[model samples]
Target: MAAQLVRAAKTESKGKPERLRFYYYTAGSGGAGPTILATSFLLLGEEVVAYNKGEKIKLKPYSGMLNIDFGKGIGKRDVYLLNLPEVRSAHDVLGIPTVSARFGTAPFFWNWGMSAMTNLLSPEFLKDRTKVQQLVQLFDPLVRAVDGIAGERVSMRVDLECTDGRHTLGLFSHRKLSISVGNATAAFALAILEGSTQPGVWFPEEPEGIAIEARELLLNRATEGTINFIMNKPPWMVETDPKELGLGIYVLQFRTQVVEITDLSGGFDLALKAADCSEVYSFEDIHENRKPPQ
Candidate 1:
């Protein structure tokens, strides 16, 4: 199937894209019983992967399984930093020079049966038709609620908030996170495939053309809800929260939209560039368990 996609991608124009300060945020749905059951591997113990100057580096992650009070939209659920195998192949195998690669998700606070469900749910294990029916009955609400979830509406969003020098805090480009759009990675993937001129197969690992197109898709994408405040600038410039963000990190929050954002900072106090995270993370020398994105 992957080979078929590669053949399909050959017709399109290939490119070298540098999408730094990337992040994935989720909200609204996805914390239900069915959703958690589907995406367990991505959430558990996965670290966000970044490729810079041909080095595959691991970024920081949130502590334990649940956020005590820090999670923005997930509400005491799980938001995990991820390392997609395809992204790794893009750099390691394809040798596509990558500025960055990242992904994250805020699953609607974990469902009650999250841990156990992950351990179970197999075709071989649950062979009986009775089990399948019972399982569907349990997650019927979640399945019915999501058609599933927003399509173009974007319940899951990927932010390519890269600057000449860029950094990230956990899943967001900014240290003090806020609510944004969610889910449309499926649409994004389909766009790449449907955009294909000739019939062939493709995998998640991007060819040059697919990588370039993916970067273009991520640019200036607005979420479904309307908002006045935006975080398009480099993390430090946007005055969001005035509290303990990052070194020189400014903040602003938008709850689903630009409503009651916590630590919403309007202006900034002029200060020297004492010590910034993006400055350090922007470089390539800090790999191999060295000082990384914090």
Candidate 2:
């Protein structure tokens, strides 16, 4: 997918990529109701940006606070990726100026361990059951709330736009993507896709987040199947009223149409059906399965 986007940008766009963005929206259930916590960061030529309180805000490299709290307030907090290294060097190779990425659960990913340490350091931890639970959840909020935070419910999206505002390339996997090669299992979300380096076969959701170059190499390496080039258009939201609502009711209330432009390619006849993979979602239903054999 990365290789395809890079090819489109290089051939269709006139100048360098204007920006690069990455997003991870985890689905969850909480007190208010079922809550979906979405965390995203954008990479501009000179700075980083995040969406908070309905506006775009700038953030520093390692010091800025990118808010992940989405009002429902389950594990609401502002932490700078806990000084983690989501910022990668792939931009240099992608022709984008920078690749600054900060996820919504990053703080929790590293901070959960902090909770363990905090309890260990406190001599009274053995006697304080309430304190132990409180401190543990306080530092690692999602330990108990796992609906959307972990597993297949987590969805990811990537965008690459040209500096000229002429092209934008986007890829969205509405759930976790995992692949198995021999004995090793690779989950796309587990790896941050730091650099351009890979040499192997590409799975449907290619678990490795294997380098962009390796996927394109499938021409001679492994092209026994088909590739899908999804084009996002028409009514993106398909609203359905649950039977519990007495036949006519809308559960979701908000909608935003993503407007991006860029080059897109590939074929969409090969959709994988694996019970183990969390992400086997399709942006559109136009596939070979729906058509008569040629």
Candidate 3:
């Protein structure tokens, strides 16, 4: 399949003979490999892949999965340094809405299973807006940041977050123009095949002239690995949590320690003498073991 795509790409460029322009969506670990390959292609003068623009392709219907890996040494304090507030403001400036109506349903299903069904049927659940609002507050900023960076709507997002003792905190937001890191490689490959040779940053769905056959072929290849495409509804539509979506388990194994210390600057000499005494004590023991006073 890859051979066929390459041949077709070569044949299509028979007359143009220009570098292929490509655009990858995300830059996370998943996207890293493809991005490197695309960049290598450019360096070798084979093709050019940019993040600014490319031929928009229609992705098949599939459910998006958001994976969050949490365990030892992960903490909220660490996540806060990422500057989520700045991200949220940037998204707002870009006219991106963080949460969709379907967003509220993710947490209910993620943290609770059958209980979610029961809660959905409860009058209190229907009447209560605070829980859903709180969830929106937590997820909106995160989703915006992810989307902004990827240059495509991410159907699924995964990250580590601090978990409370009882409930695992998780949520999903609507994607406007973000792609998953998992899809980055495939997206770039598709762009190269579709003959995107333009410059500047671009979304995968932005360009035209992408053949349907080529689009389907590339989309299939793109989704083959750890990536998935959502054609119908978002992953949260099923009312499942990150764990249920095949996301790994969340475990907290990190602890912080606090130690108190007193300044000894004024008695530095005495402290040095004490240290010297300890060293001398060790030699004295050795000397005593060997011979008296010698």
Candidate 4:
């Protein structure tokens, strides 16, 4: 079937303003695609491919996915991030609440699943003042309880007395070290931890567009690919106020190395000027050896 522009926005510039258009599509091979059944809610919701509540959609026909075009004027911060269920419901459903309500803090001190379920079943278990006080007292005495247990087994303890008490230490008194690592692996780890966050290594700057494609990929499990797009800036902005124009690179490292990039048609254009550019001479370029095919 043909692609549908499910959401579209067009804004013109007296000056520049961001505009975005979102589209979704599906395709199937050999035979016609599965039928989409529409559903309606009390208030009109965003259009969704209609499917019966309990109907199962086959894996093959639903493969063709969406393409998000965050128009030229969009900013990185302006992007709205949503999970699949939230995106499917068009943000009507609040799937998961914050950790503070379910657990006790922003970075939860307990297992998320257990704490979330506990709060889901009994709402006030973490929220109520009395319950929190009781938990604090119970956890307060856990230190002493652990100290009294004498055994040859391994033990771990959290002392909540530090000024910034969130710090944790792993102790392994009877541990043995036999893990093998070469020199290259050791140096790479050091470089990533020490070098990347420093100014000389990498620069952090504001990005140009709303990267909704990555968010969509996260939500819908889109296939592996590198997405690129161009943003056309006004002549005045490009020539006079380059920094104010705020053009920079934002690299999204793969969870796993992208074995291949499926499409590169949407790539953004960059106008590099010699005035602000630096040149470097490389002493050596690193190369990898590929294994021969069987």
Candidate 5:
């Protein structure tokens, strides 16, 4: 993706005397991944500008803030995680928003707020005071950080775990700090290919130059499948009750339309089905008899 961006920038700047400016607006885990890519482009002789929290800074080769060791095998490796103490200290002295594993401490509270309600109402976790205290300790820093905004002094620690599991991969780690490599890569690609005209900060999806064709191509490539780009249109234009769309799920049941494709093959379908006690299911089950319900 970085290579593609460099190529497009070079192509666009063929005759112009001024250098093409590349700005990478990154926060959270992007400070670890996208910063590296931007720094690589800088080393490759592309005029690149990198920013974190709207402050312009010099781009350095991937180091210091984050560290990784490639000596161990795939899921069994040690990563000297980010400097939490330094980060906390900076946030304390500079009055900047304290960064949580997620974007900011606000999300930690958001999750805790929802979880607290569930724990209070549900019998599963409410019975044990120790468990509730443990959960509180885990999130105390974030709460304190919020309180610190009002001139209160507080100390907090963030725990890091290294295990032989899917969590080893940063992108697929727990939701609190998970990063989507595909989305990030596509965002950079689109931003470069479809040069942004807007001046201030905006989401990749909000930009104008990225046409529907580019979006379709990117979505298909990233998802590795044909996409049905549904939009509000004719045919499926009936309105229904608001409760039909379940919580935490985004769905448009009215005025919906599907995009059609003419030439595509080797595509696959996935489905789920009910099984009986007599039926034997294998891990590699792909037979027509096991076909999923409509």
Candidate 6:
């Protein structure tokens, strides 16, 4: 399914409301196959994640106001989608509702690989300097905020195996989002979104994270999956410096366990696997005072 930005989310007094619509360009039969995919978006202080499968993926809501037809021709069918909170629990800490993904289901025959294509075309991955400059101009405010306070740039990276059967992984960024800030923040990356029954491990008793006082993390089984964001090296380690060369540099390195994807009537499910893709972010702290070499 081909995806494009339909509209931008408006900010609310509390935070901001995120709304996105993608269009699907279909072809061939509209049935069979249970291909699963996900999309992520950042809104206010939260992230929204949406997942969908065959014949149930919607290309309308994602179409937004922007429309395009690459002569691939569109089809009429059904679509499917699922909405989930990207940042599970951020109310207590941010004093605002976090962002979440919205989903729907329909039937259609689209490129199917559109999701991966969109990620590839995303400004972060595009090699075209003009396209990159346009993106920076469009997201100047947000980009500046992330770079200024968060100390890094925002990016989305996807890895998929179209030929071989393997689970797909999306590494939005290597910086650990603040376990405290919620939503994907350029600042305070998620060093370790982990959990353990052991004391001093820093966690709450909720399925996700607990809410109270200064805010303790609950970290349930599902939330435990968040650990996939962390790397083996120290979270704050200055592994490399790209600023000296006068370029914005960020790298996301991750390692993953092989999780073969199988399709059944019940849907695509697999053994939870891990891949190491941790990252390092280098940016000049605008707030730091400069000291000449002595």
Q: Which stretches in model 4 have alpha-carbon errors above 4 Å? A: 1-109, 112-121, 140-257, 260-294
| TM-score, one value per model | 0.39, 0.38, 0.23, 0.18, 0.21, 0.19
lDDT of 2: 0.34
> What is the overall TM-score of model 2 with all chains considered together?
0.38
Q: Compose the digit string of candidate 5's lDDT tens values, residues 1-294.
A: 212222233344333111111111121222233333222222222111233443433332221222121111111121211112233322332222322221111223332343334334443443355554565556455544544343211111121111111001111121211133554466657645665334554333333434333654553444322111111111121122112123222222221222221212222322222232122222233222132222
The regions of model 5 sitting more than 4 angstroms off are: 1-113, 117-186, 193-209, 220-294
Q: Report every candidate's CA lDDT.
A: 0.35, 0.34, 0.27, 0.20, 0.28, 0.24
Error of 6 at 242 (Å): 11
Model 6: ten consecutive residues of lowest lDDT: 1-10
Window of ten residues with lowest summed lDDT in model 4: 97-106
Badly placed stretches (over 4 Å) of model 3 are: 1-95, 99-155, 158-183, 203-219, 227-229, 234-236, 241-294
Give per-residue CA lDDT, model 6, range 1-294, as digits (tens): 001000011111132322222222222211111211212221111222332211122232222222221110121223222233322321222222322222222222132333333444542444354554454455445333433443321222222222122222222221222331254231213323332223343322232232222122221221232322311112112112112122222222212122222222232221222243322211222112111122
lDDT of 4 by residue, 1-294 (tens): 000011111122122111111221111100110111011010012112221222312221112232221211211111111112212222122111110000010111212322333325343344454554454455434322432331111111111111222211111111111111122244334444543223343211101111222222221221112121212221111111112112232221121121211212232333222334322211111011111122
RMSD of 1: 12.0
- lDDT tens string, model 2, 31-121? 1121221111111112344433224445543244454322121222333321122223344344455444543433245334433343344
Query: What ranking of all candidate models by lDDT puts the best one first?
Result: 1, 2, 5, 3, 6, 4
**Model 3 C-alpha lDDT per residue in residues 1-294, reported as the tens digit of each score:** 112222333344333111111111222212333333232222222111121122322211111222222221110111100111222321232222221110111222322332233334343442345543454455455544543444322233221111121111122222322243345566666667667434555433333333334555555555543323322221122222112112221111112211111223331211112212321112232222221132
Best by lDDT: 1
If ranked by TM-score, best first, what sequence of candidates would result?
A: 1, 2, 3, 5, 6, 4
Number of clashes recorded per candidate: 18, 7, 25, 3, 0, 54
- Lowest-lDDT window of 10 residues in candidate 3? 74-83
